[model samples]
Target: METTPAPSNVDPNRTLLLVDDDDILRERLARALAKRGYAVTTAPSVAAGITAARSNPPRYAVCDLRLADGNGLDVIAAIRDINPDARVVMLTGYGNIATAVAAVKAGAVDYMAKPADADDIDAALQASGDTKPEPPDRPMSADRVRWEHINRIYELCERNVSETARRLNMHRRTLQRILAKHSPR
Candidate 1:
């Protein structure tokens, strides 16, 4: 996606809250948003995100769906309490219909699966109420979904092959083979 230049007449007072447990992602996205002319405040957990919102609520926010401390939805709620007009987007590595619905119900303006770039995010944040942003038209194939699920579980298991294998009820060799292959499209 092409990067959007910040509006020529930028709003200096419009800050954006970015919350995510991944340090690299948070930092990188923060830089991108900053380049886009937003004052970005970042947090690593639900508590921190909420605290930041309470201290100085932002006009726009991007929250991870799953955080190390708690669900990102709570942060969204806090932002809404502080600034009901805040436009929020929920990001997730394990995106699904249920959670997408929950995010909208929790006052998120948009939801995006993992691997979303700065341009995609900027587009989501800038989109107007009359036009809702939509995800890719093609859904992940079953094999791709299974691959993603396994990878998520493996990561959660600290990349322990045996543990991931046991948790997934798959043989160790099979798990290894799956992990060795490139991710499906």
Candidate 2:
């Protein structure tokens, strides 16, 4: 529930709502955005976040896909309910196709996996809609794809290593090794 107070230079009209259960991550992001001239309001649960948005809907929002009380999609709905033009980004540690689809359906402007930094979030929020979608300049490396797939399965299995290993038909030790390594770029 603790939040960093906005400085005098921040614009009162340009509010941002950040909803996440992780205390450390929430605080860090709030400070970063506040430094960038936003008046940031933070909440740890769906109800609190919705209430904050209803009171003074933010122009921007960053919501975690999973919260202690409910899904972040609910927060998205609340934000959109008050400010249809509000830009929202959904964050998740367990990135997957299904959840990503759900996020889009719920009105998120973008979806990002965990380990995303403040700069990344900021960039997504500020990206203009005037550009056309283009094909990637380069395809992802096989290793990167494999790493993402493994992580997705692990998350779907509720972080149970054994179950994930079995589902992937991978050796338990091999799965452990992959999980232990940093995600491939």
Candidate 3:
């Protein structure tokens, strides 16, 4: 891992654990967070995350909702068990109300969808009690919102295109085409 000099305003409790299955995302986020002055430890699976937390519980954590080995909720639970004061944020590509609620229940301080910037993650980790973060200057566009909704529904349907299309009242081909395209910014 590359090293970066810590910023002057770095928190005293700057240890952080970042767990995500996506290699590219995990490495990128680790580097970004490191540059932001966090002493970041990266893990690629729930087991690894749990082990890391047990060995050295961090002051903060950012975990992906879905992982190949297990759910990120389990990681949150472990961290909370080891260090109740540790702030945790959950991230997912399949963002939905149910999972968000689950994340909060699992002791996460915040929940964000995937593609969350490093600044946002840092802000969330540093947020104190009862203090809310500022709203985004520009929220998702209508098309992006629609795409996210469709993807959420698709995930709910277990990635069954036919069922998702039926539920959305969209033509199968149209839904397929939409799903094939990349998500809007």
Candidate 4:
């Protein structure tokens, strides 16, 4: 607990601390969570997250595994120190079962890929115990992994569908068609 105060609009009881390095994504996520009526305090680096969490503890946290300054696992560690009861969801752009397992072992209640939505994160935070989802322990084929990453990133970008489409260098329709094929029946 440091001296930094919670945002004026935040109710100390139900606030959520969000730690991510990606500025645009972090801000967008904060907005989305705020729309859901949860107070949000954002930190763009590990040190900042730790300081912010210690200063104004929140009921729950969503942290990116990688950050511009350092690893977000450090943020999780600090959160646990400040409030052991705090729920945490670990997020990463490079999704892997090992990282998920490690995050849980290191204090995260759950782990997920970066493109996760605010709702998914909210669900993780709401869990009362270990919330990690153990994806099958097997190496995915390169193509399969790429496809999964693409879809995840697309979902994360939300309105930036065109950016994702451009990155893939295919027309928006092509990307849309591919996503449609993969959608569950």
Give the clash count for each candidate.
0, 0, 0, 1
Q: Which ten residues in a row have the lowest lDDT in candidate 2?
A: 130-139
Q: lDDT for model 1, please.
A: 0.86
Stretches of candidate 1 above 4 Å error?
A: 1-10, 134-149, 181-185
Task: Give TM-scores for every candidate, taking all chains together and pairing residue i with residue i.
Answer: 0.81, 0.73, 0.77, 0.67
Q: How many collisions between residues are there in candidate 4?
A: 1
Ranking by TM-score: 1, 3, 2, 4
In order, what lDDT does every prediction score?
0.86, 0.84, 0.87, 0.77
lDDT of 4 at 43: 87
lDDT of 3 at 116: 79
Please provide, for model 4 over 1-185, each residue's C-alpha lDDT reduced to its tens digit, 9 standing for 90 to 100. 11223345655577788888777888888888777667788888899898899788878888999787998888898898889988888999886888888898878888877567677777677765654443434434565656777786686677477888987787998777777675331
Question: What is the C-alpha lDDT profile of model 1 across 1-185, one tens digit per residue?
Answer: 11224455557676899999988888888878888877788999999999889888789999999999999999999999999989998999988899999999999988987656787788788888848765545666678878878998998999999999999999999999999999888
Best by TM-score: 1
Superposed model 3: Cα runs more than 4 Å off: 1-12, 145-183
Candidate 3 displacement at residue 167 in angstroms: 9.2
**lDDT minimum window of 10 residues, candidate 4:** 1-10
List clashing residue pairs in candidate 1. none
